[model samples]
Target: MTFGGLPTRWEPTGESRGVALVAPGRAYSPAAPLLEFSRRALLQHGFTVQQLWWDSTTRGEDEEPEQWVRRHVEAAHAEEEADHVLVVGKSLGTRAASYAAERGLDAIWLTPLLVDPVLAEGIAANAGRQLLVGGLVDELWDSAIARELSDNGCDVLEIADADHSMGTDDAVRTAEIHLEVARAVEAFLSQI
Candidate 1:
C-alpha cells in the first residue's frame, strides 16, 4: 500500500531491534529476489523492513530520487521509534547518500553509481557508516573510489566477474554470489 505518496511495503517484525529502509533502483523492483533475501535476513536478525519502490518511467527528467528518499526517510523516521535506522539502497537509490548522511543514517549502497560526479560527491561528503557493494565487471563501478571509501572505514564488498546486478552467466556461481551478498548485508546490519 501507499504511504504518504510513496509506494511503500512495510514488514514489521513483532519485536524490532532496528528499522531497515529499503530503496530500489530505477528499473529494479522491491520484490526482486536479492532484496527479498535481504528482508528475510533482516527479519531473522530482529529488524523491520520498509521498502520503497519507484517507477523511473513515470518520473520526469527533473525528478530527483534523492529528494524522494530524503522526504520519505524523514517522514518514516519520525514515525518509527526504533533506536537504529539503516538504509539499504540499490543503484539509483544510492543518490540519497548525501541526504542519508545529512540525517546521520547508516546506509548500504548496492551497485552504487560511483562514476557519476554528482553522485560521487554524496559518498565523499557522507560521514555516516556506509557499506558499498559492487561488482568488478560493472562499467560504472569505480574501484578507486570504493578503495578510498574502504581505506576510510566504509565496508566494501567486491564480487569478481559479477555485473551491475551482481549476477554471473553461470547459474551456480550466481546463486552463490547471491548468498554471499545476503550474508554480507546481514553482517553489516548486525554492526549498526
Candidate 2:
C-alpha cells in the first residue's frame, strides 16, 4: 500500500483520538515485535496508525539521507487530518525527530541514534512530550545523552544488557523485555 507517494500500511481505529505516524528503522518494519506491539498499544489508546516503509533504495540520487527521511515523514504527516499527532520511530526512523520537534508533536523514539548531533539536537528541541527507549549495550545509544534528555523533561527508559534491538541473547529474557517495553509504551500513551 502507498500513501503520499510512499509505501505505507494504514490501520484506522474507530473514533480515533489522534494519528500515530510510525517510522521504521533501516531493517525493522512495523510488523516487527517492538513496533507491532507499539502499534497495538496505540490502537488500544484510540489512535489511527500509519506505518511508513522505506530503505536506501528509496532515496533519490542527489538527496541526503536525513533529507530523504524527513521528506517522507513530513509528507505522511501532511496527509493526516487529526489535530493530535504522535510519531513513533525506531533506530533510523528516529530521523523524523526534527520534523516532530518542528511541529511540536508528541513522539516515541526507540533505539534512537543519539550519536548523531543532528538527531540528538532534534530530540532536545521537541516541545511536546517525548519518550526515548534505548538499551545500554547499544552502541548507538549513549547513556549520558539519554540522561541529559531526561533531565530536560523527556521520559527515558534505558534497559541494561539489552542491545540495539532492546533484547538480550536469552530468548525468554528478550520476550520479557518486549513485555516491559510494551507496558512502558502503554504508560506513556496514558499520560499523553
- Candidate 1: list runs displaced more than 4 Å: 2-14, 68-81
Q: For model 2, what is the C-alpha lDDT against the true structure?
A: 0.90
Candidate 1: which pairs clash?
Answer: none
TM-score, candidate number 1: 0.87
lDDT of 2 at 11: 60
| Per-residue C-alpha lDDT of model 1 across residues 4-47, encoded as one tens digit per residue | 57545555557787888887787777777678888787788887
- Candidate 1's displacement at residue 135, Å, is 0.3
State the displacement of the C-alpha of residue 3, model 2, in Å, after optimal TM-score superposition.
9.7
Span of 10 residues, lowest total lDDT, candidate 1:
3-12
Considering every candidate listed, which one attains the maximal TM-score? Answer: 2
Off by over 4 Å in 2: 1-13
